[model samples]
Target: MSHAKLFHPKTPEQLKRAVARCARLHSGTEAGEGIELLQTSYENNAISWFLERAKELPLGDYFLWFRKASGITFEDKNEWVPELPVLAGVNMAVVGQLKEIASLSKGHLAVVSNDGRVAVVMDSYSGFLQAEPSPEEIVYELAFWNSLG
Candidate 1:
């Protein structure tokens, strides 16, 4: 299942280059096939568009969530579970994904590559740069699906 938080590479620039290499490699000359296991979906040669946006995306703490029309956070029941924050006057919500998050994650790490695609990875023998929309479109996409329900 997709996690409730976001994660990215500890080394953004290096990861960016790795993704570029993934794009340039001859078809079937790829490294990560199990990249599909990283997230929920897979698309071959899908890194181009995401790479463009993520290329210069500076490392920053990015927290993307949807504030319900009622202002309840996480879109949970309004009166049932009042534990979730109101998301309105809150001075600080939970900490967001930090720049060095990769190192901090024990496993099931989520790395947002170029643009918004996410690669939930564990360093494999093949390589990185496995990306997809597979619920990996985080932050700006954070509350995306939640909105529909």
Candidate 2:
């Protein structure tokens, strides 16, 4: 098996644990072969800091602005055939988790599933902004969990 590192949380439990760890003290634990969880301080939250300066725009608006500002349109929303209600359930669960962590700004974390791949345009009011498909590529991870059922 390939030891690919995971940067985003794939489940509610995983997201919860990551939030807790990211918020609390970190001892440089080994998440995988090349993943290292580090303690994030207020100073490290430069994106959040910068976002705060703009009075916290909506996630969609921010996404658009990011695209315009950077002049780079990322991947388009993919089309996927969901497996009945499982995909929807997993999407809701994961989105809820992200919102709970205060990492979501508005209900704009559009989760699109297609061809066994999940895409996300998630954002945070805390200045945690990403270009597209989510910075850590975690939004696309819903496919893995959805496939388990």
Candidate 3:
């Protein structure tokens, strides 16, 4: 069932839909406790770690330099493990969705998931990533989505 070679860049709208499909698939798992953990995590406590060591270099080599130094792989090439997919699908989809909506120089408003997790990482090209709790919040959503499956 591996299709790792088939990976492609998914659009925000497509990723949003794929994430929804994954969420629905997750819902079918019938694991209420599992579902609830992500629910609570997304709803209340998402943490976004600001990497002082991972800042963009003067030459716009932030990601390259950071990858070589810290190795956290924040915004490098987002590849899907088509063979052993994480969260069955949601994480890959979310990475794609978040990249589209959050990583750009002029990022869009927001992207939401079926589990009710919301993300808004805007205006990041000019500087490093900073987390601010909106009238709502984020990494709780990230951790929740990451924790699924």
Candidate 4:
């Protein structure tokens, strides 16, 4: 299975860059052969398009999600789960870590998370992605997915 995670870019430009880097990162890897990005406009709101996509997924179910740093917040029931606060509110620390990954990758980071709390950073030049989640995050994500059932 493809590793899934939340993505939050700070701006549309970052989103675009991230997506492009994702496309490149996946284009070469056998595991990512089918990876694709749905083109969306970010003219008015930076994450409006992404939020709409997130809304389409079933609540409490694990799905690939992302938001930008300093992005808008969603009300309860508008995010991955009804009880969980908006991803923006709870995931800034994760986003902060991702920002460091992006910088280290030289802006070639694609925000694919295997769990909502962890990110798999793809290095475009090397065509490798890595996210070593803490044991606690792993167990939490397992519980989270189990709760979805």
Candidate 5:
């Protein structure tokens, strides 16, 4: 997989510019590789009536953008489906134990039924911005993920 350097931004304008650049870079790839860009703002939730809530957006916040987006849809917000079909324009799948995804770089994630068709996932987002993998490397990783399954 090819690795690319990430340009982290501290301002909204910089984030938008980075997103636009990612959009352009990803447009040249194959049709089935979906992409998304996400902004990670830490939030805290309270459980029941006994817990207190806390939230914070880091001083130097990180934006994780996906080079290949997914298009998996759900009928019920709490429902889960494994092995969603590959969309026509995007073939990357968000495997492992993820419940919801936020934004996409390109096409939506879909479920390919046993008969072979596409079912798009709605209200979800995929793509993370962190130090683990650069945006370019993420694209390669998605490609590998698509190829494997």
Candidate 6:
């Protein structure tokens, strides 16, 4: 897989150049195979590096789930579970305390927590889909399916 470096811009020209570079890099790759790129303001270099390169270098999708409060049930025995929204051609379902869903200026999807404590941002290209479920719910579901084997 190819990788691109994100530059820190000090002027409009630098910013333009960075955008141009990003466009060129994107253009050069085959469809569905472009390099995953990330950018952030330089504050803590370690955090910056981790935030920028974590998703791409690992070459995998990251799953985020919130744990439910006590006495919550994962299964709907009497009611049918509805389908989640399809984003970038993939299906996504929200569980737990997600308050809002919005696309960022750059077209990335952001899911905000109900308490406003955290937001989960997903890349439009990387197939990072979101689902809302308590960790226990996910585990139980997985276990139920795994028992078929």
TM-score of every candidate:
0.19, 0.20, 0.20, 0.23, 0.19, 0.19
Candidate 3 lDDT over residue span 1-149, tens digit each: 12112222322343343333334533464332332222222222221211111121111100100000011235685432212111212333223333322332122122223233322211111222244434332222221121223
Q: List the residue pairs that clash in candidate 6.
A: 95-132
For TM-score, the strongest prediction is 4
What's the count of clashing pairs in each model shown? 2, 5, 2, 8, 34, 1
Candidate 6 segments whose C-alpha is farther than 4 A from its true place: 1-11, 29-50, 54-104, 108-149
lDDT tens readout by residue for model 5, 1-149: 01212323221233233323334434453334432222221211101100110011111122223223322467743322222222222222222211233223222222222222211121123444464343432221111111112
Please report the TM-score between candidate 6 and the true structure: 0.19
Task: State the local distance difference test value for candidate 5.
Answer: 0.24
Q: Compute the lDDT for candidate 6.
A: 0.24
In candidate 6, what are the lDDT values of residues 1-149, reduced to their tens digit?
01212211221232222223343444454222323433322213213332333222222221222121112245652321112221211112322112222211122222222221222332222122134323222111100000111
Scored by CA lDDT, what does every candidate get?
A: 0.27, 0.25, 0.24, 0.28, 0.24, 0.24
By summed lDDT, which 10 consecutive residues of candidate 3 come out lowest?
61-70
Cα lDDT for residue 29, candidate 2: 44
Global Cα lDDT for candidate 2: 0.25
**Model 2 clashing-pair count:** 5
lDDT tens digits, residue span 6-32, model 1: 222122342333333333333345553
- The predicted structure with the larger TM-score, 2 or 4, is 4
In the predicted model 4, the residue pairs found to clash are 4-113, 4-114, 5-113, 7-65, 7-66, 7-67, 8-67, 9-68
Quantify how close model 6 is to the true structure by its C-alpha RMSD in Å.
20.7
Error of 2 at 108 (Å): 18
RMSD of 3: 15.8
Q: Quote the lDDT for 70 in model 5.
A: 27
